[model samples]
Target: MRAPARLREDGPLRATLVAIGLAVFGIAATQFTTLPAFLLEPALQGTPTDASIEARTMLLILNFLGFVLAGGIYLSATDRGWSYVDLRMPTRRGWLYVAAGVVGSVVFFVAVSALVQLLSLPTAESQVMDFVGDDQTMVLVMILIVFFFNAPAEEFLFRNVIQKRLYSAFSRMQAVVAASAVFALVHFPVYTAYADSLGATAISLSVVFGGSIIFGYLYAKTDNLVVPTVAHAAFNAFQFGLLYVALEYDIEEAQPAPSHAIDVVLALC
Candidate 1:
């Protein structure tokens, strides 16, 4: 803990490269660790159990860990602590920011839905949501895990580490746009893993890119990662909460039950 500050303090290029390099290696480490279940079936090994559920959940956990590892490496290399990435605990006003952000997130969803409809934007269900489906037990556990792990990791890397550095190196708009673009680009794996069409992937990427811009701007304005982190987690949690609500609602009704949340949401269409 007493190591001297050895890395340079102000080089955006170095910071960006270090962050990205660590992220790539971390992802590869996770992918290698979790590839077996996809390649081998339990029945073939006489296990006679569906390991797919565990496998999928592990992937989410591991990916979150990977992003954390990336942040850890960047911090270590930079000889800085969490504050270097604007991860200070929120003040009273910060809490208010978070509360307001939740409302903004709800508005974001509605606005984006309208945008998609207006543009005829291709859309596809996110695969992460599959791991967080209507199983209440699973959903409850994932909410905390995602709030603490995935949302924090992403905000740390994208806003604190990358955008913070960019802010010092360039104008505010350049910093936010560049950092958000990188944030959105890194999500390409989801496209390959889940999207059925190029148009679907494009729209998904565009939405994520736009969301990243919002998060980046939030972090810039508030000077706290917690604000954006909480907002991002809230948005995701609400999305899942909606699914759970619709599912439970239909399960109560005598009408035909939907297989997934989209079916319930798609009634608008």
Candidate 2:
């Protein structure tokens, strides 16, 4: 009875618990690996040059863990017997969805940037000059990896797996909120990385968590990760492009932006 009950009764809950637990593990792992930078960057490197590299590597590993946990949740919670779906291939309509998401994200991003100023939140402004210098090959490869591969992988994990699985046991709003909270928690490292003040980090995290819930809702309603993934990828790409433009063009100031991802979320029900 115990064995059968464990397999069938509390499967989703168990999976969710595991998912959250693994999140802690992943964060601790990254923190442990990068502790040297936090303590020794100023003394050894004279600057935080290698600090950013460690952060990026940590992000990559976290994403990988997210994929695993999401996959586990999807399999455990859903009745569907399908194995992992290939995110690399999209249908014709999927492409259209991607385009629509890009446009919607841009509008939302610009609007939120303007709106956050009204709240008197301190948003920093800085830019990186191109992704890998003037090398065209590097840019192309980076775009391919980010858009075609990494973005889709993340979307499938969050939307199709974690969000959907949670919705089975939790209310739609609760599921969205949970997924978004987890998403924000996964990004805690970045909060510490770029923020100079605790106040700034708190504000930024609120914005991120809030916006993530919206994205989760959209993903739930659409029942397709393609739209959300495309939006996510496009937003990042635009940000990269913006960084390049700002760094190369010598802008006196670029406003710090807050994410408003919830704008795209319209409940299908």
Candidate 3:
């Protein structure tokens, strides 16, 4: 199956608009998926300062489903089917990219953190930090969620769907940049929840943008969805694991840096 002629023949302007529209719809769909989590909130209320594990777990699961729903709908609408996504097991060379992606992501985050601190840029912490508190168990659960569900879902929507859609009218790098921008923009509201100023929000979004570019690039280079998905999952899982260690050992330095918290809720989109 193939996409409609209009979609396949889209000029730059039309492609940009369509890609943005699809991205917006995907974001809305994911947000809508979290609605049911609210129902569980009252029933699963925890301490006043913390969200219940049940509620958090429900939200994570719903988020995964929502992203998958968005991707599925797009494929159906375009008549492209799952085959259009280029999903396959990674080759040995692809595995090298996966390793590079994971390591590069960590290095990128560390470099960005150092730059932010050096420049004294204002940055916002994720609201998730409040809910996580000192709960190592919650952090452990989040690690599992990010690895198994969150990373795969977001990669499917943003990289496989939206980025690939843009390729009809843009260069590979252009598509990656445009899709990364959209990914970062969609995350704005979540970061703003704890932002004290626009600078703080911008800093957080910049990190997201950079990280997304890495994911997009991996997808483009490998032409294998699992490459980026596993890379994304491993990076996020690493952060959550670090947080768990921080909570367990009370190592402040081991805690996620300001923008690093963005990964914690990246799937909550």
Candidate 4:
């Protein structure tokens, strides 16, 4: 499906504005999902850490709905229905791309971890790690959540919606880069909660940015949202699964602690 005529006619400046507006709306909608978590705060209080599996699960479900709402509202307003985004069952070749995307993303993550360790770069653990915190049950549940909701929702909004929209004016590479920047920046608040300093936060954001770039490139190449969605989901599921193993076996070196060198590799595995 072609983009709406209005969007097709947009110049770079106008397209960039629209992409930014959509990103802002998407971020706000997802943030609104946290309101229900406040109600759970009473139950969540006095936890060893601030994270609660129940609250986190609820929030992720709400976030999935919120992202869908945001994307739907924007598409409706723009007269571009859901079909405008390239979401479909993957073709055989598309499945190959999906496999490549997943493996490439994992390799990229490992490379970044090694780089960080070799340089002793300041970094922060993802806030999601806090939600799992030595709980095998939480890790298992979060693995499902990341696969079914968290990864798909974020990919739908960022890669399918934002990156595709940017294609109206920007080249594929440009759109991918821009969408990735937005994706990374939107997670700044979440990362900051666990980051010790601005440098640490920046490093965390860099990792997100790099990962988003991989997802965006997959979407651009395959022209199918499913390619990136599955890849992203698998990447995230790997992390949660690794965390589960760490908790189950009491693998102290593999726990996602920012101070541990091996944790970085395992965290992204």
Candidate 5:
């Protein structure tokens, strides 16, 4: 779609490499700073705490930077500036696609979470729920990480850059498949580290990869990154808000579960 947005050899390659390198760095950096804050300071593995809030906030900021850098690289690589495009706003059909993506993602989360619980997968290294039921500021900060930082950055890398690059090199259909695989690779460490059951992990990840394919197609069809970016953002924002409500009301566990759907989506990509 849209001729795969011709690439400038040096322009795209340089940018992509930088983005990937930075993301790798972010992972290392995140662990070094985050582990101690989460584990040593308060050590609240099951419940939300002030220390956990600080630790997660710090790590989230780092994670946000990683996504921003990568997204910047990806956008530059395609010569698609950061400016938003209003060309053909979401048609009814486009809205349908977005809706499907959201529904599928939710199903994936529920199924995966259930599997993780049933299988007794290893718990997340840090206490994710420990951020819930805390100060409103802490909750807001967590929201920023999941919605603002994590979602956009990830979709840009997976859907915008990798998906488009592969699409440039191959047919549209093949590009979708290839991008889906690459997206899945990004989640390897997280998924393996988080999932409780092998079978559930596999099935859930398949759902994730599948979602990537869909998102990739949406980007290709629209030749616009905003569509996928918004889709990604909306999906994440919804989950975060829902989780916040659940935790705030004590209806669901506050900390993020390893089998968390959004996490799976990231892994799927």
Candidate 6:
């Protein structure tokens, strides 16, 4: 009873910790569930090109479920009703934030790509392209996933649940930084594959952290998840759309972004 009471009484700090734990569990869940399903898919049998596409698609779906469950259970235990997280479609002002986020993210992405290139840093191939492997059908499906499910779900879990809870535990700046850092660090496992070496990995991770800070800032500043959510969607849509065009045209000249993905898939973990 005492332990349960503490869990109940604990505020943002406790919620944040629990969110992190559940996130780990969620990632583990992917290992057992999504990974195997993808590997054993009859459609992908003898089609190694489809290996990452099917596997990661399932992984994204499961991760969304896990994040939602984590946030939901935390809300229930903390007695913070659904209203505690503001996810309503933003009014006109919120739209401005969303627009800014999209433009800012694009500007940031371009700037970072140039900086990475100049610095001789490693850049990651677009994971979407890596996975779909000339599979047009999967490409279209992933586009839909990116625009609809992946973007909104990640914002709800990370910004609405995790980052928002952190605010109760620290100053807004501190909380945003902490949340953004955790957001960035969680992606460490991905950098190795995206980067060529430790130095390049660091640079790539910095881009992720920087982008998260922007996302976190928007969430914190606007006092709503709407800004970051839409912004994230737009950003992802831009990238995925670009990738689709590149693939369809077989455009070899376009440089893949040096992305240190934030949301596991950089859209959601």
**Top of the candidates by lDDT:** 3
- Residues 65-128, candidate 2, lDDT per residue (tens digit)? 4454546554655554345343444567666666666776677666766666677776422212
For candidate 6, write residues 151-261 as lDDT tens digits: 666677777877776765566777788777777667777766666678766776688788888888889888888789888877876776766677788886453452233
Off by over 4 Å in 4: 1-8, 44-55, 256-269
RMSD of 1: 7.3
Q: How many steric clashes between backbone atoms does each model show?
A: 0, 0, 0, 0, 10, 1
TM-score of 4: 0.86
Cα-based TM-score, every candidate: 0.73, 0.62, 0.88, 0.86, 0.63, 0.80
Candidate 6: where is the Cα deviation over 4 Å? 1-19, 29-36, 39-48, 51-59, 124-126, 255-269
> Which residue segments of model 5 deviate by more than 4 Å?
1-55, 71-96, 107-127, 130-140, 252-269
Q: Indicate which candidate wins on TM-score.
A: 3
> Ten-residue segment with the worst summed lDDT in candidate 3?
258-267
lDDT of 4 by residue, 1-269 (tens): 56678767889888777777887787678657656765666443234235566775676577566777899899899888987778789999999999998899889778887888899988876544544566778777767876787777778888888898889888899999999887776666666665788899898788878888988999999989889989988887776666677778888656542212112212221
Model 5 lDDT on a 0 to 1 scale: 0.56
User: Which one wins by TM-score: 5 or 6?
Assistant: 6
User: Cα-based RMSD of the predictions, in order?
Assistant: 7.3, 8.4, 3.2, 4.8, 6.4, 5.0
Better by lDDT, candidate 4 or 2: 4
TM-score quality measure for candidate 2: 0.62
Alpha carbon lDDT of residue 136, candidate 4?
Answer: 78
- Write the candidate numbers in order of decreasing lDDT: 3, 4, 6, 1, 5, 2
lDDT of each: 0.61, 0.51, 0.79, 0.73, 0.56, 0.66
The digit string of per-residue lDDT tens for model 3 on 1-269 reads 35567766889888778778877787678678877876667432334135578787787678677878988998998898988888889999999999999999999988987888789888886655655677777788877887778888889888899999888878889999999988887777776776899889998888889999999999989878999999998998887877788878889866785324233344343
Off by over 4 Å in 3: 1-8, 43-51, 257-269
Task: Tell how far residue 124 is off in model 5, in angstroms.
Answer: 8.0
Query: Tens digits of per-residue lDDT for model 5 on 39-66?
Result: 5554433343535566646545554455
Ranking by TM-score: 3, 4, 6, 1, 5, 2
Whole-model lDDT, model 6 = 0.66
Which window of ten consecutive residues has the lowest lDDT sum in model 2? 260-269
